[model samples]
Target: MVLWVFGYGSLIWKAGFRYEERLVGFINGYSRVFYQGSTDHRGTPDYPGRTVTLEPSHGEVCWGVAYKVSGEEDEQIALSYLEVREKQYDTKVYLDFFTDPNTTTPAVSGVMVYIGSPNKKLNPNYLGPASLEEIAEQIINAEGPSGPNRDYIFQLENALLEIGCEDKHVMDLANAVRKTLSEMKMDS
Candidate 1:
């Protein structure tokens, strides 16, 4: 069977896997937050990097992309790759994807999404609810096998802009990180 996967974070900028089709869309009833800690991709265990996790928010819609895996073999490969890449995200949910941000019609249904829950037990790497500056500070100096954590924020910001999706949280954090980086350069 074909599979549809929703990308709200790094997946937007880098799918890192093969897919038959990709469509820009959004899902309702969720708000993207940088509440998940990333020890594997963006930081070490000692200093975990912050990443996006969808928090259940009524009346909120998170804009992202949906990738369709057509072949069964390709679907298996894509899911396996994602499972490893998103190892820290312990929860998975399915939601309807709407291409039109303002429309209620779903272009695709039962699109899979990986989530890092706020429950510490379920999501061991969850670092829930921090101030914008606090998160930027953590993101600033954090690096992992993937690369600098700051790059993640900037890339996501740019990707969202490219897709015509204006996310306040992402924009604010990106600005904060940029300002912090500028201040650091001035200080040195």
Candidate 2:
């Protein structure tokens, strides 16, 4: 059985695991939101970076890439890699599809997704929901061992566009960040 992993955020640009194949796909009944906070990869505990989380929204689809792992061993390796990378999320096996626009093959199913719940007590970085301006402010001021929070947003925006996916929320946040940075430069 092929193991499929769905990536809607950083994994689109920075999937550290090896995969046999990848396809553009979307998971239905869920919407992507920057409601999850990042205290490790993107920011420190004192100032966390906003990251995407899959929230249930009927009739909505979250577009992303699905990576296919070949065998049992690779599946284990991929799972292990994702465990460290996506430690903040709660894993779930979803019946989703990975579609290739140019292929005659039908969409693939049984894709696994990582989701973070706002009410989950284990996730200290879970910031739940916030206004766009509030998120942008935190992102603009956050810098962690990985890099600046702005860089993460910029890269994810670029990656989404490149993959033929448009996320208005992410793009809007990116724009806000840019505007805030410009204002800060002028003030300084």
Candidate 3:
């Protein structure tokens, strides 16, 4: 058995599991946003950090990486690892994966993607929408077991760039986080 898993967040840069193949691709009808609260990874319950989640948007394409896990044992191990790591993402969907956003046909189909929803009931860690500055400020100050929240944004920004995909939302937030960190340092 073979399984394709999509990684739009930390998975892009830090897919901790073993996979046979990796492909850069985009999933349709979803725009990535820093709306999910990361209490476990990037911050604490008292001060949760923002992370990426797919918000349904027509004509939108979120680019990331797709890892191919082959062998029944490897697929099971990968899925088990992912289930624990991505516990916060309450929804899992298998969607067609495309190499290009403008592509008429998908390069791979039935790729599994973990999604965190805006509904508070479904995703208790949903931070929802905030102004750029507000989100940046939160990201700048929050830290958890994983590391600093700002580092998450920076790493994700760099990872996306490395893949030759530029996400404006990620870029803008990364810039905001940088500016916010700079201003805080100057004020100190």
Candidate 4:
């Protein structure tokens, strides 16, 4: 059996796992938003960095990459890695990805997607929704073991653009963060 993983955020650029193949795909009925907070990878508990989450939105589609993990052993290994990397999210199987945006074909079925829940009881770092300015402020001033939160947003935006995908939400947040950083540099 083969395992398929759907990546819409950092996983799109930094998979950190082995995959037999990758395909650019679009998942409908969901929208990506910077609503999840990261305390381990991008920020500390006191100053969590903002991250993307799949929010339910009818008629909305999120473009991302789908990784195919072959063999049972590799699937297990991939799952283990994702469990740690996506500890803040709940894994769900989604079959709405179309490898070709123009067609209704699925590159891989039963694709596992990491979804963030905004329940404080479930995830202490969950920071629901915030304005772009607010998110930029937090991202610019946040850093963790992985690196600066600003880097994450920049990388994701670049990756999406590289794949010929244009996400206004991501671009807007990225632009805001850049503007904030530029102003800070000028002030210093």
Candidate 5:
């Protein structure tokens, strides 16, 4: 049997999936944004702040990468993905062919990754009502096992916008974070 997986946000740039093709794909009924903070990449796992998830129900397009997995290494690939995706996101099995009708990519099937379950422990809204800039700053300024979450957010945003997603909520949140961070600079 063959397995496929889809990546929208960090997965787009990150994922580290092994498969046949890295075709451009899209996932509907969900859009990408810098809403969730990553602990492994952005924060600490003990705090476990790093993660990606859909916010409410927004109808929009999101650019992503799809991979086709097969062979003896398939389970290994999935295990690695599960490790990176962590337990916060749901790991549901999905077909690997069929572009999102709303987004319009080539015909293909793959697994759609999402936050595993709605556990209040998963989301604490710790950063408060900060804007995109503030969030971006935290990501950049804050040290993580990797680098900064800000870079990840910016890259993902760029990827989405480059594909013409233009999610209003994503834009607004990013803008707010930027504004707050900029003001803090003046104050300091």
Candidate 6:
């Protein structure tokens, strides 16, 4: 059984399972924008947020990678991504999307995905503005069982770049984190 998954934000490249098919999907109603969405280590419950959502279907093209997997693999992928966003909302899905017609790659088959949820009831106080600078600073400065957000930024950055779906918000966070780390080094 082949399963199709949609990754609008970070999951496109972050999936731990291997996919048989890969395509560039243009998801409607959403853009790669960062807003406070979760309490998970990646984005926080409220303040320290990451970009992931759809406002209005503006027809704006964002690159998403679709992958095919079996039922067991699908569950594992979902479980491996076990975080507040996935469990709290369970909003990942596999739906209609138009891929670039120009590409010579074969059209991928449709399947299931983990769609993002609409439950905003988890919103919390803003630790700060939802800026790349802010997110980077928070991750760099974060402490607790959560670990460092900068590490998440770096790993996500590498994976996204490898897949060619790099987002401005992510890059911004990377740079901000790097700068802050460098400054901290000098201060030390």
**Candidate number achieving the greatest TM-score relative to the actual structure:** 1
TM-score of each: 0.98, 0.92, 0.97, 0.96, 0.70, 0.65
| Per-residue lDDT over 1-188 for candidate 3, one digit per residue giving the tens place of the 0 to 100 score | 68999999999999989999999989999999999999999999999999999999998889999999999999989999999999998999999999976668999899999999877898999999999999999999899999999999999999999999899999999999888778878999
Better of 1 and 2 by lDDT: 1
User: Candidate 3: what lDDT?
Assistant: 0.94
The TM-score between candidate 5 and the true structure equals 0.70
Q: In candidate 2, where is summed lDDT lowest over 10 consecutive residues?
A: 97-106
Question: Which runs of model 3 end up more than 4 angstroms from their true locations?
Answer: none
Best first by lDDT, ranked: 1, 3, 4, 2, 5, 6
Arranged by TM-score with the best first, the candidates are 1, 3, 4, 2, 5, 6
**Candidate 2, clashing residue pairs?**
none
Measured by lDDT, the strongest candidate is 1
**Model 1, runs deviating above 4 Å:** none
lDDT of each: 0.94, 0.85, 0.94, 0.89, 0.58, 0.56
Q: Which residue pairs of candidate 3 clash? A: none
TM-score of 3: 0.97
The C-alpha stretches of model 5 lying farther than 4 A from their native spots are 33-37, 45-51, 55-61, 90-106, 121-142
Worst 10 residues of 3 by lDDT: 99-108
Error of 5 at 13 (Å): 1.3
Worst ten-residue run, lDDT, model 5?
122-131
* RMSD, one per candidate, in order: 0.8, 2.3, 0.9, 1.1, 4.0, 4.6
Q: lDDT per residue, candidate 6, 60-87, as tens digits?
A: 5555666666677675775465444355
Off by over 4 Å in 6: 8-10, 17-29, 36-57, 71-85, 97-119, 122-129, 143-147
> Model 1, range 62-96, lDDT digits (tens) per residue?
99999999888998899999999999999999999
Residue 167 error for model 6, in Å? 2.3
TM-score: model 1 vs. ground truth: 0.98
Point out the worst 10-residue segment of candidate 4 by lDDT.
Answer: 90-99
